[model samples]
Target: RTLLSARAPVTLISTSGDPPLHIAAERPSAAATLATLIDAGAPLAMRDGRRQTALHIAARAGNSVAVATLLGARCDPELRDRWHRTALHWAVVNGQLGAATLLVAAGATVNGVPMPIKKHLKKTSLPLEAPLHSAARLNPASGAQMIELLLRAKADPNLRDQFGQTAMQVAQGAGWSPAQLSLAWEQQYVHGLDYLRAGSNHSR
Candidate 1:
């Protein structure tokens, strides 16, 4: 409050690459603190060391209230982090379905692909990835729910990652049986065959 009253630059980056807003957004009691910062003219779009915005931090922390506050503040849900992953990707990867849902409702692209990192940022080339790929590869236990949410939001079931594999293929390679995928699909979309047919056609 003192610094803010004194007009201290709220956008100053910390050594960890987070701004004050990003740090505050990580806590469950973040709503008041975030609102204060935003009201004090804090820039909501500033990125941390990893290029993650306040919304990304809130999503990764599973802080749905904070995510909602940020969204209400008109933060860009589509902003990408250093890994080219949006808040939706982080939310799905962390199994924060609430946060993912909020992001999806805020117009985050369900099938948006991560941008490839520059060569200097990696020892070897890395491929772009989609939110579904993260859910399938990193959060398979609840990935079906995440997939359902994305699918309901009109995510492309057949969207492939840099590895040239769809989310279902990734799930299958990760030991999710065809039965599991089928059941998950049925649970979300009543006309499951449409999505299945789309996936099959895209693979060809």
Candidate 2:
């Protein structure tokens, strides 16, 4: 705060190439600091060495407060990192339910958008899959809640990835058979559709 008050550059890069806002975002309790940096004119869209904005870092860390702070500041929720993953993707993959919910509410796309993959450059390059695909890869018993949340956000279960596999197929490949996964979520599925319908009606 003192440095900021004295006009310390909020955009200063660390040795590892993270800006001050990006660094502050990694701290769960640093929402206030993040606001201060934003007020001090930190670039909301600035990317670090990882080519991620502060929003991506916060969502990956499961920092709901930080996610809210950035979202409130109108950060582009759909901004993609080097891997073409949005903050919503990070939240789902990391099992950060709260952050994922917030991102969804803020209008991140629930469907998979085509993202070019450079297979030769990065071994971790993900298939062109939506956040639900990441959720499907998680342990079904543990990941049911995430799938529910995504469903509430109207994520299409039948949406296919670059490999022509739907999220259900991905989950099945991960050892969660359709019957097993469906049984786990059967009761909640209707409720999710009801909620989604309510939201759509309200929006209309």
Cα lDDT, model 2, residue 72: 93
Q: Which ten residues in a row have the lowest lDDT in candidate 2?
A: 191-200
RMSD of each: 3.6, 7.6
For model 1, give the 10-residue run with minimal summed lDDT.
117-126
Tens digits of per-residue lDDT, candidate 1, 1-204, equal 777778788886678777889989999876787889989888888877778899999999999999999999999988887667789889988999999999999999988754454542473343576787777765455888888888888877667776677777777778776677786666555655555556668778
In candidate 2, stretches whose alpha carbon ends up further than 4 angstroms from where it belongs are 116-124, 177-179, 184-204
Q: Point out where model 1 deviates above 4 Å.
A: 114-126, 138-140, 187-204
| Whole-model lDDT values for every prediction | 0.80, 0.80
Q: In candidate 1, which residue pairs clash?
A: 17-48, 17-49
Full-model lDDT, candidate 1: 0.80
